[model samples]
Target: MTDVQRGTEQASWRTLPGFTTVRTYQPRWLSRDLVAGLVLTTLLVPQGMAYAELAGLPPITGLYTTVLALLGYAVFGPSRVLVLGPDSSLGPMIAATVIPLVTANGDPGRAVAYASMLALMVGAITVLAGIFRLGFVADLLSKPTQLGYMNGLALTILVGQLPKLFGFSVDADNFLDEAAGFFRGLVDGDTVGPALAVGVGSLILILLFQRILPRVPGVLVAVVLAIGCVTLFDLPERGVDVVGPMPEGLPPFVIPSVPLEDFGLLLAGALGIALVSLTDTISTASVFAARRGEEVSADREMVAVGAASIAAGLFQGFPVSTSGSRTAVAAQNGAKTQVTGLVGALAIAALLVFAPGLLRNLPQPTLAAVVIAASLSLADLPGLRRLGRQRRSDFVLALAAFLGVALLGVLPGIGIAVGLSILVVFNRAWRPHQAVLGRSEDLAGYHDLTFHPATTHLPGLVIYRFDAPLFFANARSFRDQVRALAAAEPRPAWILVAAEPITDIDTTAADMLGDLVRGLHEQGIRLVFAELKDPVRRRLDHYELTDTIKPGDFFETIRMAVEAYQASTGRTWERGPGSYEIPD
Candidate 1:
């Protein structure tokens, strides 16, 4: 390439967040980033390995995935302090995706290959979604359902880790079976005392340190102490399992070539993974970015996430997502830029290259303890409780989601959450909130008649408000409500609709409106509209329903509509002894 072309390319590279951060790098911030990165690296190693085991992959891939993901996001991601790695939330999901495809023959290598392929596909999906500006896809899972799903997932992970933490393996499928197996084993005196003590002790140490010393790396300290204890006491002789050291070096960069027939299944898994990953990334980006008084472009964040996944996939790693705990750790330690991520990535890489056997004596139960501790953070029981006490419908939705995940499994739980979201939206729009409006003495222009029971009402005018877009599903309800308003005592001369809440009008609704207009005219009653938006007006014109109502029937405000009614009918509303209206 020519020098000018190369310079242009370099200038284009400046669009990347990491490059910009480097070009405008501040020297004073370097020390803080260095220290924060080192601190973050301590959490990354154990959590990465633990989450990998949670995903049913070998421990080493977690470290590999973490290094590559951090490096990749630092280059392309929008948020500077957001950390990416193998997340506990994605662990069961990754296992759900690849284990079915790999477990038949019990080949660990085959599981790795399927997971890598899954990551590549997930990357492709997220990148395309970003390029197309489809960040709204994250809304597929609503807040209540997401809470329910996470609660279910956390419980699942906690239970699954019980066997490992107790120093035994229980062969089971699904949450119930796993729970049953654990309890059955416990009853059978199958728990190894030494392993249980180490695991439970490690768990207690991590949780206590987190609560007592928020700044310390509890997982690192617990791992160190456990390893030392194992080494000093030779705990392996007591049937205690250790993670053993990772492979000496990173896996080679190779495109995972899986059986073509598995593509269909893997693609299904990828879609679910991509959705959860992007939703999580977007939410995290919003939070951490808000802390610094900045906003993150969701599209750019999605692209960055895709790049991270692809980077990890090439190294035979699994799906990864942002870790709120690790990011908080970095920020707490004064991370100033993506350089912290780069520094952390490089430091982990150095460990992999130089001291591959650093964790050789790391007890497997300690790893299980790490996972259990992380899982505890994933649940939000208070949120679930608040939901239950706040709204009955939302509480029902959350309960369904929780049950779906607990009984059905992780992937199906996501499917349930998304489905529930769609249903709730439809239910709201279909029934909606309708109100009859009247002028009250204490209120300003108008108020719901249900609340202002004594408000003044004009003898020949009725004002109605429907708080939803006019769509096919609710057209008939609108028709019936208007007809009921018109049928009330002594009948009305005009029905004036408060159109501000009716944001749009579909063809079916327009047709229904035309019919209502004709019927009102036959009864010598006029139909009128006020505060209709221009877009809805244009839609009415397109539907040709404007031809049904005289051009004079439309008003820009309720005041104007009321004035027109008084001018034509010589009627007015005012506070009186019984009725607020005084007929002229």
Candidate 2:
């Protein structure tokens, strides 16, 4: 099909009935959506407060974030079931951004203002990225690297919140000081009384509920039970610190104060925040989209999340992203449209207006327990284990990211992870596997490379495959491989490159291919290509390499190429080619 026709067909398929499987949006679905919203809101309430604490802001700001972000995402987001709110992945990120400019626990108003400005900056960046369709940039961080970074961030957040759980605050700004302070507090052990009891009790209950009945919202249940216990038994009189009264009603829209002197610092911090927000939003959206058998538009999601952040900034909120837990809840509850998120936002709004004080007496330890539980879910132990079993290099990358977050901090950890991922990419490109492939002995009508030591390769006719895109990093290696193979005994007159796996080619690779073609022609050898993608073909054409090689040499399939070459040479083969005479 033509490119325009294919694009039109794909667009039309988007409107088909089974495209999203969200047909029959009846009232029953709405009722289920409302119930799911209430369940998620219960969990979000304490989570918002805890994440706010992690972000170096007052607890009420968490509620403000929850309400505004929920409402914002409901309108613009494409995922009908995705729940957008304050996220644990973004907690340490925000803390890293704001803690440097506004001292922790030092001027609360200035901290909030800086946070709001950060949100605005991040929003603007995301919107611009969406406008320019830069969502492909997120692909820079590989899945393994992202897994490592998230595991590291989870550990940092879990440890950082421990001091609050113990009712005494530490003066640590980053992960190292937080770790040191945690150990110091452990050594003292003098401040451990009602708060410790409440914290430990809440943790056990949450863990138990998670293990015994995962369907139940353990965090929400723990919060309610903890609050009831505190109120019924007067635990606060015995040194247990409660969350205290939260201001009711919505946050009024106001412009954040931006100081000229701190613009550079805030801009750098906002860049980091924008990256984290984009990474987390796309990752979560892709997960849900795959489960629903849908393809997510990365650019569209960027616009949705950008608008959500802008709305959040205007209403005294911080950065927000898609929450995996809440999205799973909505999907499980049979959410059929964006109405599910709308219902969730309305539920939170109603709570903010009428029942803001309901959680006033909620124990700080309980909130900590909830945050810790949520953070633990992001650990990704299975991914770590798979890395260890599959590739040692990936295991090292994961460990480095973990240590970076635990010792250095969130921003540094992300930088290190991205660096490691890039290093891996370069390492592979620099020395890509160029295997001699042929038909598998045991498999029928299929081709495979012989990686085993005992396997033998066919002589004269060389069929080689490179596993990565041809680029500047590996152009020299490609030339070397072709030269070395051409010099081997019983030199092949025909060389077929299995180019199905090569998805891209840079100018350097194109130039190298042209040189290789001329060199092979000098030796009276035919250079052929099979299964080349259209993009690669275009690159070759652009560089005039296609004209250098005969038009008949490019074949759509390896089987076809092999057959054509054998027929052209008038050779009948019982097995693969054994040897051939060099053209003199």
Candidate 3:
């Protein structure tokens, strides 16, 4: 290719993910994308409105969030078919962050502005993270921690919505308080029977459709049917609260303005939102990419989702995330590219402009039911069961996370989960498993001496295995274990370390090793290592331990180390029953 053409291609490759997708756009995929977009629109409309309500924003703002986020993702996203929109998981977070700041003012517009600014901050942080290629931040939430957080969030959401589902307005804070209010309202007979009927009926229908039909748009059908029933029977006159009319046009382009005094609070909330949003988006993108046998660039995904959040904020909407249900609809309906998302956005916009009155009679409780259904899916009881059965320690961590979120509020619960995740990682490394190696008749390779009582150890030789990286936290433990082995009654002349699992060695560990070597030499017990990695060996050289311990002390394999020990001692070896061999 020509140099100019090659340079242009390289620049294009470096552009946003959507640009690359569009550059290689296939004409035949347009029809499929259009169909997928239409199918996705069904779920988007109801979910957008419901999640917006969940976030304590006007229902119309959900449409705005849905449209702008989808369009933004379509223009910048890396995935072929990921959908971005108002999410159930993020709704409570946004509400918690923005509500307190705006509640005193009692100004709905200011509340929206604060939420939008929060989204803007989230966008800025996420974009910066992407620019710096900090995709590893997603690993902050380990699988068990994530499952626990989700389960807790799910319970909180479900309980919080119970008041609305029962057709009563309860003024309370936190999940437990709200639940108490719900029960009190029930005892007082404050719930409107008609609204309760609509909500419970809608939830049941949606669940049944999901279980039986699978292919049907259960949420859309339930919502539409509920709206029709309410409107046809004049349920509003019978005490059912309706969504009321919404503005019939696109969202206005406005810069969100927040009070300077509240900037710190917004910043704090934004950090939490960004963490949750990016984690959810990256995870959803990874899952979809894996199913299609494609690789997802975490940095690119971050940039795409960040751009979507910024777009939503600029359009007077709160932050958004990858929606599992909407994305599944797109994928199941044959979405082929980001074009599907763009089409869905346009479809939502058209609905707002032309048919805003169609859902005016939709019952509020039914919307709550929709959100509650989504929250139910997030519970993940089966995952908890699997963790309990597979790894008991992980199960404890997961259970702790679940309790933290369920009992505490969402934001505080997330903080607890993060701290616990760090502890779980540190605990593993701080007290990692160690073993002594011996030849066992039943095992192919060397087995742990303590586990195999009948296994035999070489005379005057001790093969110790430290199965973790040597760092400051564990360095002392390593020294203690080695010294204890040396102090044993049958003191070994040669202590050979199977260093294959010791991937890294830090400065503290190097110093510890230096001390260990000098102490072992005084006892006439040689300290040797077998199968040390090149990087670790280089680290030892840098520490000047190579001069203290001769280069010949390190060997490539256990058998080679044994051979060298025999050669140094001028000993002869022969094979017999229950004996080991040294290969030439």
Candidate 4:
């Protein structure tokens, strides 16, 4: 290739998303980006460290992760205003995956290594998925399931943080155990009065500001006030834990390397984490993209998030995902592009280098309070209530997912959620909705017999509609319905399938149809199809079964089929007395 062409090709790949945003940078948006960036840093610092703590990592690692993730996403992420960082949802998953893997002494460094490795693996998985255009994997968890999982997750986080909030420690792992341990501690008088005062005061302050001053960053306010209170009252002497001086400067770029045995476990956790991250990112991106009048490129987003994950992992940080709350804050503050993220990252870097002790006096319980507030936002009881009122089936699915997460550990909960979602999809296809068609005097087309029971049908013909594709799972159901139609009193001369909804016919279904056709022929009944899609017809022909279905059995439309049937049988449509529906 010529040098110019080579350079141009390089430029094309480089223009994945973020760089294009840079090239087309608007001068008018700079001030807005700067201000929004500064405003975002307020939440970024506290929440990042708090989430890091939540994930069983050093608080400074959260800052490192936040900085790298933000900078990396700015270069690759398609969404201009989405804020990527350590998230509350991912924290529990990280802790669940990494904490147990640590040595008996609970090596902090080993935990960091495992988490960073997980981030790397998650990044690789997401990037590969994006490259293969597997972005639709994000739909693995349906909306109801997602809501339930989040609610369960919220409860888990809230309970897990309660011990910290009450100025005590719990020696339990899972949510149930932790809840029991927390209560036992409460009864044993583990609560530190002064520490509880600081924690509750911070929690109330954050909640009050969120409720009364929605625009203000309540987390930052709470952090500042809690630090002041701890410092002025010398709360550390009264049994309150605090974050001390952070490690100076940025972490050098170095990949986290863990034991080979841990690779399988880390990768497993990464798969679940990657899926959740993609689902969370795509949902948040869609909302922000719609608000800005842009279409969401989910694949690009997955790749971007992957890049961000890799960057953070290399810097000894855990996995990151888009924060909808943070994005909303940035958008509300007039953020125009990733420049806001750049500002936030740089500000955090400055804090690390210039003032590592800024939050030294901030109480650990205050951080717990920050996490509790975030967890509160994750629950959606109103959404669950709506699901219950809207449809019982949907409510059941949501409730099942909720129970799965609440009872099982976080990683296992995700597995159960995915499994339940897949089962729901398979059940729909396994026993699909089938309808018998009859003519209504006032209607334009044939109507479902179940809905319009008093409609008319020709005496010797039956029209059946199966509302799903013909596949291995539902093929038997379809055959049984057809057999039932053939067995009716004065058995139908023809059983015509309204094939519009049967989008595809798989090989197993094709063989089933072939056998059914031969059986019906012996019974003196002809099978006919109307409104069949061309692709499906092609598949039937490929199976060499179309020729066996009689020369003139297929018709372009239901009307054409009716006309042919009427002409051949010399019969007109008959009116049924009272209600008429399929016997079985």
Candidate 5:
């Protein structure tokens, strides 16, 4: 190859996230990865099938999604052990999007096509986000809100699947109505006894095995048992619903055939799916990486997951995300590289090609049991308890998200949860805590005077600290607070701002600072900044405020500012009263 062509190829390879890991692969790790992959396959098979049903698609679509998504992620995913697949958390989201557009005639093919389009759109958005290095977009969904959303989602999934578990169905519009309908079914003797027996029995076995023999594939065991009983006894004739025959061979590549009129709804659904999947993937990847003493690049993860989604979409499957449970299973089984994921994908593909009817007798209730088990894990009751004990407001926010999902449908609930999270962020920024700085003999640096009420500030020097960044929302409050402090008894000569926490200074804030500087200067008081970050200082410069405020007014630290004040005035102020050790 020519030199320019070779260099271009190398540069292109450099952009692929997992290329470095693949290049550094060791042969010794292969045996362990292969074993882990085989072990993971047991769980992945049942999970993919179950989640596919949850997504309102044929069980075989789950296998197709599982195969392609794993292969795609293995090629581009950055993490050594993150396993991507059909996720239970995203199943309802897929259903919410595709169910409405499906025709009254119940054309499953068109439904699948629309869902594929949503996945494609989500994949494009995620890829563009990664290319632009907008990984922080995931941070928009805060932990409290995420916990609440997942908890709500768990309840939603559980409630929706309960009727199916009992060999029945509900035609309600919302969660409460559906839940009520399920109860009415039970009261009216509408539930099938055989299906309920299989489902409940399978659920109990799965739960018990999980508790007693954690490493055992309880889901697979339970599913196999259910299938065996149904097949041997001819349970279908006894009013039990089985998955029946799955499509044989590989998934055919199909371009989505959605119309232009429905593009807006699909686009909205794609954004929601992308946000949830991206947030879940990054968070799950980060947790696993941290456990292994490794680092996670969120942008790279977006690329990997986006690639997986696109690959799945191309094969007539819905979106996929990082599976925390499957990845944990892979880790516990000693997964050493992306080869583990590749092996699992190959195993599923082989199953589809060679053993398509293996699970033909698998009861629908058993599948529902599998889904209910997975959904139960995402409940996060302990996390909620922790939040309640540690932070009340956060707990309330989480509760809001839970209620939003439980009361509204999945799509609207996600919108409500995300909106609530953003509002909480804005609320904190709008009314952030500020403090007047004072010194204690026991502590080396300045502390909040409210907590150390007996401590005193240096006379005629007002030291103030704003706990949040200076922005348009809080600028006016900051100005008023500083003005109030200046008007207190024993007027101050200088105001030194401890600005370490003020990481950003927007245009509105800079303008407010300019007005404050002029107002303070008119009253024989000079405004000074200590511990201000370089970037924030540069912003002040851009606003042309640095020219008006002398260069000498800036200090690297609070101590330097204090020393400068002493040097100019020759004052040694007396220390405050409180001298005891502060309790944390």
Candidate 6:
């Protein structure tokens, strides 16, 4: 076929009849969405501020994050109920990037600028990645690695928030020192009475509500109770650390200034943030899409997330990703469209404008409690257990990621995860499965490979099936196995490779196969290929290996090869070429 006709045929295959399904958009589902939106908004308000604090920025920045992300993602995002905003996952990452650049006391303005720059960089990266359909890059961080990384992050967040909960300040930058500071403070009983009482009370309320109410917003309830108690008793005056007055008015749009010296530093941090953010977003989107029986375009979702982050950055917000908790809340509350998210954003904006004072009396301990409680859900013990049970190698990967985060840092942890995932890929490719196959007499029209030791090889012919793509990693092993098979006693006159499972052949493997074919030809044996995919065939053709092998040697199916062999032999051979024959 001509190149144009071949291209057309490939395009037609992608849109085959069975794969073309339409999406059903239901506008009527919005009738009860307002109530759901209200519930989600209530939960989002305090959580947003808490995450902003976690990100080492002013709490109001969290409000800005909620406004822009919700609106932006609602319009472009694929998921109807995915709530995008300030995320705990991105909190430590932002802090890691911003903390080193700013002064010890923290430059609120400069921090905001840095955050915007990081957001812009991340947005650009995501958009470019989406445009290039590089969504598969997220798979570089294997599931085990993510589990470990999250566990370590949860511990770090819990440790970092402890001082705030006790109304004491720690000057530690890293996780180890922060943990040590927490323990020292605990041992010395440096906890402020009012802050400790409020923190412990909030924790109790959240725990009780979660156990009893189950469906209600436990953290929101805890916040309300804590704030109400602190306000009624005037606890701040008695030494309780309160959030104190928040800035009013909408976030004004301003371009962030980047220092020429720090451009490389900021860019590197942004790349790390972008990769993790995309990984988290795609994963969360896939989970919801699967539940709804909806298909998610990962590349499109990346664009949506990128747009949200860019909008947020410009509007005085930091990096954001899809929140599993918020998405669950939206889904459970029956959100049917992005309108619910838009409504939630409107609600938060109203809160920021009108009730800014209400947050002033909110105790820092209560906010810490909120963060600790939210992070606890992200620990993912069940996922770790599942990984251990289903995939042992992945279990080790998860452990490595967890330890990397705990012992090293977020960046190092991510580096370890990616490295481990790549190693796993290479390990699999290095030693792919190869098996001898034969026709099954007991089964109708089926080929079965005898895996038991009692089965013996047939004389004069050998059939082998390679269960992976032919690549440079395993080319040497492939050559060794083929040579070994040819040198065996009662050497096979014909060696048919069941190429159905071999998806692609690299240049190195193609050259090795060509040499193997020539070697076999000199040894008075023929090398045949059966059930080769068009792509693999094209690669062989490109390498000029097609001319070396006779046209009739490349059978479309193993059955065709068996039929051809029987016709050539014409002995009514008791069994097929590779099959063991029993004396009758």
**What is candidate 2's TM-score against the reference?**
0.86
Residue pairs with clashing backbones, model 6: 144-398
Name model 6 segments beyond 4 Å from true.
Answer: 1-31, 444-457, 566-584
Looking at model 6, residue 542 earns an lDDT score of 84
Q: Write the per-residue lDDT of candidate 5 for residues 103-185, one digit (tens) a residue.
A: 76578888889888888898999999998999998988889989999999999999999999999988876789989999999
Q: TM-scores of the models, in the given order?
A: 0.96, 0.86, 0.95, 0.97, 0.94, 0.89
User: How does model 5 score by TM-score?
Assistant: 0.94
RMSD in Å for model 6: 6.2
By lDDT, the better pick of 3 and 6 is: 3
User: Which portions of model 4 miss their true places by more than 4 Å?
Assistant: 1-15, 577-580
Ranking of candidates on TM-score, top first: 4, 1, 3, 5, 6, 2
Clashing residue pairs in candidate 1 are 574-580
**Of the pair 2 and 6, which is ahead by lDDT?**
6
Better of 2 and 5 by lDDT: 5
* Each candidate structure's count of clashing pairs: 1, 0, 0, 0, 0, 1
Give Cα distance to truth, residue 179, candidate 4, Å: 0.6
lDDT of 4 by residue, 1-584 (tens): 99999898677656466767767899999999999999999999999999999999999999999999999999998888999999999999999889889976688888988999999999999999999999999999998889889999999999999999999999887889999999999999999998898888888988998889877998888899899988899999999999987789888888777889878888889999999999999999999889889999889999999999999999999999999989988999999999999999999999999999888898999999999999999999999999999988988888888888888888988888898889989999998888888888888898887777645678788888999999999999999889988888778888899999999999999999999999999999989999999899988998999568765999999999988999999988776722324555
Give candidate 5's error at residue 328 in angstroms.
1.8
Model 6 agreement with the true structure over 1-584: per-residue lDDT tens digits: 99999888665433321111113445576665787898898788888999999988999999999999998886667677788999887888888888788878867999998998888888888988987999998888877787898998888888889999998978887889998998898899888988899998998887787778867998888888888988799898878988889987778997788687887877877887888888989888889999999988888888888988999999889888989888888888888777788889988888778877878888989989989987787799889999999988889889888888877877777778788888988888888777767645555433445443223333566677778899999998878877777877666677778899899999999899888899999998888889999888887888888778768889998777866766775524334444432111
RMSD of each: 3.0, 5.4, 3.3, 1.7, 3.0, 6.2
Regions of candidate 1 where Cα sits further than 4 Å from its true position: 1-15, 574-584
Query: How high is the CA lDDT of each candidate model?
Result: 0.89, 0.79, 0.87, 0.90, 0.88, 0.82
* Candidate 6 overall lDDT versus native: 0.82
lDDT per residue (tens digit) for residues 184-242 in model 2: 98788746578887887888888887789766877777888888889888998988888
